[model samples]
Target: MAGPVILLVAAFATLVAALLFGGGAAPLVIADAGPVVRWGLPIVKLVVNLAAAGMLGALVLALFALKTGERAFDLALDTASVSAAVFTIGSAVTGFFTFVNVFNAAPSADAVFGDQLGRFLVDTELGRTWLITTIAGAVITVLAFAVRSWTPTLIVALLAAAALVPMGTQGHSGDLANHDIAMVSLVIHIIAAAVWLGGLLLLIVIRPVTDRAPMIAILRRYSAIALAAFVVVAISGTVRATVAVGDLPSLLTPYGGILLVKVAALLGMGLFGAWYRLRLIGRMAADAASRHFWILVTVELALMGIASGAAAALARTAPPSETAPAFVRTPAEQLTDAPVPPELTFDRWFTAWNVDLIWAFVVGFGLFFYLAGVWRLHRRGDRWPVYRTVLWVLGMLLLLWVTCGPVNAYQDYLFSVHMVGHMLLTMAIPLLLVPGSPVTLALRTIRKRDDGTRGGREWIMWAVHTPFAKVVTHPLFAAANFVASLWIFYYTDLFRWSLYDHLGHEWMTVHFLITGYLFVLSLIGIDPVPYRFPYPFRLLTLGGVIAIHAFFGVAIMMQTGLFAAEWFGAMGRTWGPTPIEDQYIGGGAAWSIGEIPALILGVTVAIQWSRSDDRLQRSQDRHADRTGDAELEAYNARLAAMAEKDARAGR
Candidate 1:
């Protein structure tokens, strides 16, 4: 009770102070919505942010920290439900206020005003975003209250996270130079912050009802989660600030100052998290230190409030970066929302860079976790093959390059480069990644939890063994999916979607990677799956896939028409090959460069098949040696009996 009250009071106070300091609520020169609307909008938005955090955080922590069917788990869900209700109301109110601010229309009983408001919600992009957000919030509110089990609760949590997406899209990213990067960073920042802040709030709520032993255990689990959240929050925050501030000189501006205050609050919270992780969590197991832990928690919540306030105020403060230029610079720039790069030279293939922060993080964390797993095995006197580690590192590095390097840098303008990235993502990288046998490493290294609560190890096990996993990892299905993906993605509107939408591009990357990984894993991976094809059948599957894959590429090469002509053809690239020529090159990449890896896979499968036969023959020879050819004697006896029966018949 005291925690929530204290947090809100602190948040409101700081929001008011920051708004005044930043002139966020100052009178606008044009289309001013008056003092009440200006002040009221930010205040309502702040409430929405807090409510979102509480809804999502409680659900996430409940999934990770508390055992199902327990009082603590139920209480966490209850908290989520209550918070979701608040979120639903807050989102609706925020939407109305936004409409008022944008249209400067007063709430009234007139039917004309009603019709206009209805049109605004239906017709405008901003209105649609808010309406969707409100609907998602309302859905989450019901689901959170109705569901208490693991899977259902998890679904609700995901929905709650999705509800935040509209807000992320509504931010200043649309007006920024690095639109994709800014949008992605803001989304990550919002979700991570929600999880961190909401989890702590959940802990505070469930403390009174939970046993001391379980409470401490939950605290320890949450500390791990908080640490991860902090890293994401910090990185995303840095990216957001870098784009928003433009240059160091802008740091002295009002938006920058408000951002600095938020940074300070985050730093303070990080320190408090470190203390709790290293020392306080352990001490809290004892009665003497429990009081101290709660006290510190209160202070940490206050700091979170300050951050929340500063963030809300920052939203209202215009960045020093020049507003998105009014005039179009070029056709490419108009379409891509970015300037065209210099000519595509041979050297640019190696030297060019365009960082996709999402993949960069994925690669970073993937390497870190994989190496950590291997290290754990070594420390336990187990010898994980060194080659696996090397291969995994190579795969991750290649993925990093494909996603964040030259291929990514030029893919938007050059169809050939996009195909190059696709090949690497689907074929080359998966070839290396499968042999690394990441799942095997994880199963061998990650400590299993005896507690009923699900942890990383438990979740991993659950995922791999699920019915859906069985279907996807089946050799025939995986191969079919792998072959079908290339044709489907390249031939459909999905191709255009990937070109025009950042999320769609990310989806393509992940979808291809997974399909390829499943295919390879079924063939030659060391990780255990529900089933694997026999070596001969595996080769047959590979052969079928290669034929289909080649035909798809040939179809593309033979086509006179270009895919996504509006995008690829309209890129206005002067130095690169013509769009049709680039498409041909892309088809060549798919057929020629891509087939090299597929052939490699085929050869590897053949080798494993031969080795399997040799191993079986050795086992039989060892049996003969141990049993002195007993099977041979039995065979001879049976033959002699048949000969004696023939002799008797002749007599």
Candidate 2:
């Protein structure tokens, strides 16, 4: 019944989405009416979004159940996830065609496409559809599967943030501020909903397996968490609802009517939660009325599902963007235009990318070679195939040289480009490189040839696996790397001025890559280190770094007011923000929610620390309690006496 009911709701939603969005897309075939002009795409996208969220949620539940080994909470999470998966997969399939016609066909940066592409995306329904799906995917996944552990928390948090990406400028919503607010509120809603609901799942499942006496302790801690989650859901939800509904009259409107239904569902969930906690749960805990608890939680889960489905629609289907892309018929109608194609204007970046096309392939194949070598060594643990390793090194050199060419030619744009480049190099490259352990593995191969550790890879290992390595690998160091780099570059204009000149620009790129490499290495934990810290410290440091990052963002945001730097103004009005507002948002982004990443880090570190501590403590306790033969005991006693004698003598 639960399965069929959820599936029916999902199918109905998808059908409504199809009629409104995809069916409407037939208008796009006209020259003036590409998909960007259609309504069907957005509707289809909404359906896809719901489907994906539903599917992923189900997968998460199934995994949780397996881990719990058939606990009731596990079973419920599994059930809820099943429902979620239905919605998610259905939405994804329905939305895939739209994404194909939208972001894929729509206009992208010239580097990716031409001006016509941008026009198609900006002027059409296709862009809207893609934006909605991307953001929705990021959000829904977080809600469903992001809560397995700290690891999942980190993943989900990141995805939730990603959901806000399209809401930025490219989101074409023109209301970045509103979108920002919605995104933040939505994130709060998801975290609160998952924690609160997931806990209910846990409370129901665990209580049955454990004794009632322990329930008090468990419930005491969990209830506090659920309470906090409830408060967040209530406050943020109210704000979200208010913004979404726009006014009281909306309740009577068709769209508003759906929203009301969703709200009612959430309210029902809340009521059920109250009943379980206030009336039924206590008695259920004391007595053996576990079935009643299950029944109530399932009801809550069902309500949450309904509410989430409505929210999925409301979140992305924001009543059309207020800001429309302004295209000028006259070549000089004077809009904010990206600077490129000095010789001639092209449709998109890719349109003029004869040179870039070749470069892309070069980089792609080179990376493939490097990866193949890495896999071979890791799998075989030998240098019998030595030529591939050489090719790998040469390929890296070639890649660096290729990048160097652009570094010299576009020195003027280096600073801005450097920021973008750093993000890619640090984020994309090292994670792949380190996991292969090429450096270490290569060293191992070299050492075997010499059969000694005088000056081979063994020595390299000694250096990397040393105290300094340990220190750098510490949470403190990673935090420092993440925070200090930005402040050093931006707060002090040394980084700023450095990128403006040709020579300085070259050095800037170099530094950017090196720093990024270290930062990511520390973050991804690919390299080995001995020093460690506790979870509490890890969390604090993570929070600290986020706080620091937020501070920089705040400072940049504030620059919108009459601050120094003609460069900012020269970039045009849109490029530069008012110092005060920019500073506020920058800091807000930095401080307001930056702690999320840190919280995740702290959890990871804490879990590791806890496991290690437990193992060490247990080992020590076991060793102390060891039983042995008489002779061994006598020998130990003699050694103790000798140690006592030596201590007395020294005193």
Candidate 3:
């Protein structure tokens, strides 16, 4: 069922991508691109996205009912519910390709396309065949959906729909008069929607906290659902672009830039999710703080939404606005004087970092190996490192402090460079830092154990395992690192200042790395912290933070005026330097309108934590109920008596 759903999504993605990228059309082909897009494939994506969204909404509602044993939302869920979420995501993917087809460049042939899609598009034998295909597919899919519950019907319908999208585009190769209505926006929207749908399916199959029967078996089923979703998200995304755009420059265009970001975020989410499911979900079985899985799933779903929906809007916009001016009337050609070469500045140098060389070739990962191993050692007995761990950490901190200049300088205006900096400080560093066991080291370093301390182990344990620690390590606080930083830096003067002044820049880098690292750690549960908040609190906290952060990005995009700091403006690449388009893409990503992707991410993390917590709670309960362990009880009783006698003697 899951496989077929995915295949349908793939078919739709392929058709849309082919039209968008395969020399489809340029903005010149359609002056008023909005309506063409609105009527065309965009409508198709909208249908799929809306359907997928309905399914997810239903799933969430059903989950609530199941958990609480309530009947209130049953009708709504029943009406919306499809047999399988995995199928919905895949079918929705076809909808996305249909979405891309909407923004085709048919304005040049308005006499044929204006309020009349059946005109030039379906006039020819090829066009007529394509139209027939779409009608046929939509009908068959509906029939199939009725016959077989969720997944199978969705696959058939979606596959048929996918074949119809490219044919809807009214143009083909060598038809330069016709433009490609298939926008990046539409493609992104479809991808994001699929992820959202897939994630909801994951929720159904996963270990439902509310399930009272064959609980473990149910969890295994949930895992399978999540796996299906994961595969669909990846496959659909890949196929869409492969068929959409043809060349490297197309990928580099402003339209493509946004697509790149969405894809990157998806990739990151995928890698992170895989790690949790495949590796550490079990080790955390006894930890109380594992409930963060839900929070991660939520965030992942939300991000996916922003990326996809923004893409939908982008689909309606003109072709790459940053392309070479159609008619170049340059004063440089008129002037005989040789232009003086501008002196290269620090920002220029930093922005020009060949990431292939630095991030790929010279990551300096050895520091992590040594640092994490040394820190882990600190978790054990009184063995201090030959050298002080605090001093070592402080020194590494100094090295990172300098990353501000290099990282910031490398990203003049490109989002990708900025992303690299984000990755380093956030994802890579924190993963290593937690394993190094910074929290435990601080404790060992500060306390002198042999110095007549009463209730030493108990006191230390209590502080280490406090509610406060768990809360800080929770996914909510960690997401604050990612979501909040993006808001603070991008939407305000903070972004400019972080790159302008030395100190501000330093702190910016510092905060970025710390937050990023911490967020990942909190999700994964590698290190222990001081605050241990419950799952519900973490989910709400992270969700709220993500919404606010996404809003800030949206605000920046919606504005018509300049937003970058004064210094940034002086440097020539202000917020409004480019057409409001790129900003729009970024904003959409920030808004998380790509649909339910972030939610999925939040849930993925949350499930892992829940599974861990459930296992631990059961373990502790077993140990606590050991009425048959007479020797262990006797040992404790004897120890209690000896302690009493020792106190009396001292008195």
| lDDT (Cα) of model 2 | 0.48
Error of 1 at 230 (Å): 0.5
Pairwise lDDT winner, candidates 2 and 3: 2
Report the C-alpha lDDT of model 3 over 1-651, residue by residue, as the tens digit: 242243335434533453354233334454434434444544354344545444443343233222212232233233243522333444443333333344453334556444354452355444454445445434443443353232333344355334333333322211211111122222332433443454344443333333433333223334444554555456545544544555567877655655675677567566756665565345334344245544454555544444444344334333442233335332321121112123335555434321211122112333453465565556765575554455445434533432534544334343333444554454445544544454455444433334222122324555557676566556656666577677667667777665543335546766776675566555544345654446666666657765765566557667675545233223333333243454455455445432243464367569967897999998777876776666678999999999999999999
Q: Model 3 TM-score?
A: 0.31
**True-structure lDDT of candidate 3:** 0.45
Across residues 1-651, which tens digit of lDDT does each residue of candidate 1 receive?
Answer: 688888898899989999999999999898888888899989989999999999999999998889999999999988888888888888888888888889989888999888988898899988898888889888988888899898899889889988998888776788888888888889889999999999999998998898888888899899989998999999999999999999999989989898999999999999998986788778876876888888888989999999999999988888888485776478888878887899888898789988887888899889999999998888889998899899999999999999989998889998888888998888999999999998889888877888899988888888888898999998889988998888888878998898888888889999999998998999999788999999989988888888888887888889899888888888778786899999999998888877899889999999999999999999999999999989999999999999999999999
* lDDT values, one for every candidate: 0.89, 0.48, 0.45
- Highest-scoring model, lDDT: 1
Q: How much lDDT does candidate 1 score?
A: 0.89
List TM-score per model, in order: 0.97, 0.41, 0.31
| Candidates ranked by TM-score | 1, 2, 3
- Higher-scoring candidate on TM-score, 2 or 3: 2
Q: How close is candidate 2 to the true structure, as a TM-score?
A: 0.41
- TM-score winner, 1 or 3: 1
Q: For model 2, how does the per-residue alpha-carbon lDDT over 216-323 read when each residue is reduced to its tens digit?
A: 544544554666567667766776566555668666654465566667877787777677677655665545565676566667666665665565455334332233
Candidate 2 minimal-lDDT segment of 10 residues: 329-338
